[model samples]
Target: MDRQEDRHRLDLRLALADLVADTAACVRFFSRLPVPKLCSADDPARLPDFSQISRAIPLAGIVVAMPAGLLVLLLGLSQLPTLASGFLVVGMLAMVTGALHEDGLADVADGFFGGHTPERRLEIMKDSRIGAFGSIALIVSLGLKAVLIAALLDRYTPLEAMVILLGAESLGRTLIVWQWSTLPAARPDGLAHRFGVPISKTFKQACIFGAACLLPTLPVLPLPSLALGLILAPLAAHGVGMLAKARIGGFSGDVLGAVQQVGTLVFLAGCLAVA
Candidate 1:
């Protein structure tokens, strides 16, 4: 019994260490933040819970996926010398997020537009199958993104293009944190609970996570942009919150994702318009 107790205590310590390391890894990935190696795929022993990493998921997403947008802009720059890369960068970045929120947009559209009642809407949203309204929503959203991005790339240089990609992604992820903190879970025991931390932790993460977004904007836009972004984030979140209330009756994981993606686009659009 004594030996077994010792082994259990040792296992618990190791598990805690692993969770800390994974969270660090996620943050490092998001901010282009660096860290020493911690875990490997070949390890035979099971590590810790993946829940801690959820806090940094958005950050990690931006780090891993933003480059795709850059690549698309580069391709456009090479092919069309007259146009700048900014638009392409934005468009590509949207794609890089893999139309993640766009999927939410589609789901919401189908649910709200087609279903007669709130319960019916929720039912439609839960269905994995896509509907006509959803399909149309996806097409239109993607088309808008493609056109806007192409326009930006046409106007801006490669460096500006890069900043836009990074900024938009970081901003988007930061926006996602707000939803996580503020919105009530739409479905009981759904995906939100798995990823949801306490509001206090969520706020701390938002502040730290926000730096990735705000730092880049300092050079690109003026104080107005900064002020606007700060103000707009919550307003945009509130708007989505209302939409969530009306449609799904609350925020689901899909709605949360939609908010992030939509919020990013809205922020970028507002910034550029000010510029």
Candidate 2:
């Protein structure tokens, strides 16, 4: 009995350590923010296995966005111009995330729109050059985000606005689990291939993460209105998945990024409308 108890405790300790490492890996991958220095020797590098870290991806989003959210709140409360504050928050987040998702949005726009064939589309996305399609998409998406943030500033108190931002960021990352779960890689290489599909169990854990993100803000929000905001995420993801199926025949890294970007926009938009 003593031996069994020790073994169980040992196992639990190892699991917790792995969780901390994976969380650090995720934060490093998803943001430019400095990590906690617990794993200083390796925290800057992207870890080999994203699947192990998938569970923390949503939390990573909250981690990355919180600073930007705070900045927005500060600016709003200080009586800065709403649109200017919104754009600054958007730009700051772009920098903080190393423009990862925005890059994906541009690549997806160029690939999905510019390629006459699926192979051509995938090739274009990999080119790293911005085309007319990518240019327009970047401008539009950024514009939309700024507009939404500004609208939220007008509609809610600074703290309430921050809640919407936090929830949207968390929920948006969680929504990527659907893309990974439902789709295959567009090519035989790259992130979609490397990470593969997260198992059903993993996917469910992501949903729980997203729920944890949203539930905290619920007390301040109307249930019916919050439902309206919450409903946009999956519906938008379904639409993104369907388009990927028809166009690329599967998801690529760009598709995953596109999902996050769209999820962010629609979730915040829903919250604004409902609020």
Candidate 3:
């Protein structure tokens, strides 16, 4: 029965393989974290299942944002001005994520506000060049985030500040997944289209995963912060999604990025309010 045992063993190994691959795939896709090897030269099509991997986006957020939060914490401990610490934290996030969300925000602003029609809007979004609308929107969005993060530093202990940062990161990314799951891709091809839309099942799992990622800080985070983050983040996502659907015909990669940027601000504001 050695052959039978070998077949059973192979089945178990295949089953166990998915547990790690799914999480690694999300982390690899969203951040610069050194996740498990995902690419297969042997078979290019044998890639990680992004549909399943979407469920781990929030968990990936924790991995991605930790360094930025820790840097801010250390800066605060060193008696740096709150503004500088906030600025550094924002910089860290941009550097780590390659400013993908920020890029998305600018593109969405340029496309949605600059274009006269849906077709024109999608074309504008695809352009790499930033315009006046994008310039203004990025400045406004980033400025608000920096100011609010500074407010958090002023209102709470360094440890709590880190917790708040983590919560915001997790919540912001969850919104991206939620938006992607619900909205149709606005264009025939692009980053967002290549990624494809997540199904309802994936969306629900992502929400649960995002919430679970915040569990460590639940005891220390202000009750109001918790409540507000939940409410505000989704509202931000839904509002932006609705706007994209109406303006551009549906969501694009840029729309996903824009929502994450916007959702982070609202989520942080809500949490900072009760902090």
Candidate 4:
């Protein structure tokens, strides 16, 4: 019995260590945050293994958005104009993630609309320059998100607003993982392809973890709003997936980014509509 107890404790410790390491890997991958290496075995130069680390992506999303959420809470307490506070929080989020998803939205817009051929579209997406379609896409998405967030702030208390923000961030990332798991990489050589599609078990675990992350908001948000947000967010992601399939045959990194942006917006919208 003594030996069995010792082995069980060892197993629990190892699992805890792995959980910390995976969360750290996801934070490093998704944001520009300066997270120190949590595990001795982690290589600083190596990319995270998404197949494993993807399970922690939703948790990482909360960590990534925590600063912005705090900022919104402060602004709310200060009685700042709702619209202005919304824009500020959105801007802070962009800075936090280095506008990573926004850039992808722009790239997808440019590629999908500007180029007639798949080869040309892929080329356009790879281009560093932003075209007219890309510019317009960025403007519309950013403006819409700001408006929706402002509406939420105007309707709810600061604490509730913070929960909503965290929920949106995590749900958006869950959608990203969903797409990464379900769709094949559009290009043979790109970051998405290199990360590789997660196995079925990893995807299921990620969904479970992602759902767990949203539980905190249940007490703060209405049941109908939360349910609507959950439903609509995944539907929006599905629409994006269908569009990507029709245009490029599969998803690229940019497509995944687009999915996140769209998913986040739809989730917020659904929540606000019934809140």
Candidate 5:
């Protein structure tokens, strides 16, 4: 019995360590944060194994957004104007993430609309220059997010608004994982293809973890609004998936980013509607 108990304890310790490592990997991948390498065997320069780290993506999302959320709380307590605070928090988030999703959204907009064929679209996406479509897309998405965040702040308390921001961020990253898992890579040599599609088990684990991350908002948000947001967010992501399927034949890294942006917007909008 003593030996069995010791082995069980060892197992639990190893599992906890692995979970921490995975979450760190995800944080490193998703944000520009200089998180230390937790697992020595894993290469620091290479892309994280999304298949394994995906289970912690939701938690990583919360971790990534924590700084911006804290900023919101601070600004709210300072009695800053809601609109200005909203823009500042949004800017902070963009800085934290190195504007990764925003860049992807811009690329997707430019590529999907600028070219007549998939080949040309892919070429356009690979180009570093931002065009008219990309510029317009960045303005609209960022503007909408700031406005919606301001609206939420105007209605809810600082703490509640912070929770809502965290929930939105978590849900957005969860949708990215979902789209990455469900859709095939659109290009053979693209980042999405190289990263590899996550298996069903990984996706299911992500959903479970993502749901757990959202639980904090239960007390802050109205139940009906929460449910509406939950239902609409995934649908918005699915619409992005469908558009990707039709436009480029499958998903790419840009598509995943687009998924995150659109899903987040829908979730926040739904919540704000009834708040």
Candidate 6:
């Protein structure tokens, strides 16, 4: 009876681990983890904790999205004769990310650029209606990415483009992590705080994730260009951090999403300009 009880306890522990892992897995993909019914939105007691979980979703988004980009490159190359398919593959991958960050990017552009005060800016961002600025920003950002990727496809071999896309996505998400670590939450209770909640990350974990992202990229470009990409990662993060601080007095979910989207685009633009 004692042995059976011990085994049952262990099984319960394992099940709990699986559940938490599911939550973390969702965070890794969505960058906004959803709260379970146990912590319903209506329950004020759950609000504080649920808020943190929600913000971690974008981190997960980066983790999952990078591989999707690589898959697109692989499939596109496999069907090289059908070049149009490559564009569709990439577009589909973007959709998989739910375009959460892209939407935030457009909203931020519209709100920040259109409004003169912080209150007005935040209000504009909160509005569901997209404005002229948001629409234009979205079109330009997406168009630039498509154009740049297509051009690279036309010129470079499949392997080279795949590496770049993967590297950019990983590096861009890493920037979000970096930004989250350094900045204060813009509001007393906003989505970004969950990620910004300071936790000690080990150097080993950093290197492991960094190596996973950068190693594949090393073979694509020359040593010098690879170095440039590495250098730009920190620089871009810092630039966005400054902008975010200046705008909202700190970072929010929108700012984090904007950082990832802008950082990825900036890296891609750099790759194209140099090549």
What TM-score does prediction 3 earn? 0.88
Model 1: per-residue lDDT, tens digit, 1-275?
99999999989888666545555565453333344555542122333222344455545555644575557546655866423343454445445445556667778878878899888988898788899998987776556555555545655665565566566666766666666666677777766555444365645665575675557657765677556756776578678878888776778767766776677666666665664
- Give all TM-scores, in the order shown: 0.73, 0.91, 0.88, 0.96, 0.96, 0.73
lDDT (CA) per prediction? 0.62, 0.82, 0.81, 0.88, 0.89, 0.64
Tell me which residue pairs clash in candidate 2. none
| Reference-based lDDT, residue 9, model 4 | 100
Supply every candidate's count of residue pairs whose N, Cα or C atoms clash at under 3 angstroms.
9, 0, 0, 0, 0, 10
Task: Estimate candidate 4's alpha-carbon lDDT, on a 0 to 1 scale.
Answer: 0.88
Worst 10 residues of 6 by lDDT: 38-47
* Candidate 1 local Cα displacement, residue 32, angstroms: 18
Worst 10 residues of 3 by lDDT: 39-48
Instruction: Give the per-residue lDDT of model 2 (tens digit) for 129-232.
Output: 89999999889989999999998888878898888888888888898877877887778877856664677777787778778888777876777667877888
lDDT of 3 at 95: 85
Q: Over the full model, what C-alpha lDDT does candidate 3 score relative to the true structure?
A: 0.81
Count clashing residue pairs in model 1.
9
lDDT of 4 by residue, 81-198 (tens): 8999989999999999999999999999999999998888999999999999999999999998889878878888888888889989999998988988888778888766577677
Q: What is the lDDT of residue 270 in candidate 2?
A: 78
Per-residue lDDT tens digits for candidate 3, residues 162-222, read 8878878888889998888888778778555566567778889888988887786687677
Q: In candidate 6, how many Å is residue 89 off?
A: 4.1
Off by over 4 Å in 6: 1-63, 78-90, 193-208
Looking at model 4, residue 184 earns an lDDT score of: 70
Candidate 6 per-residue lDDT, tens place, 1-275, comes to 99999999989877555435433544434533343443212331322332233233333444556555666567656655434544564476567667777888887888778888877887788888899999998888777777767766766776677667767776676666567667877777676444334233422333345457667666677776666666775687688788767876667767777887788777777666665
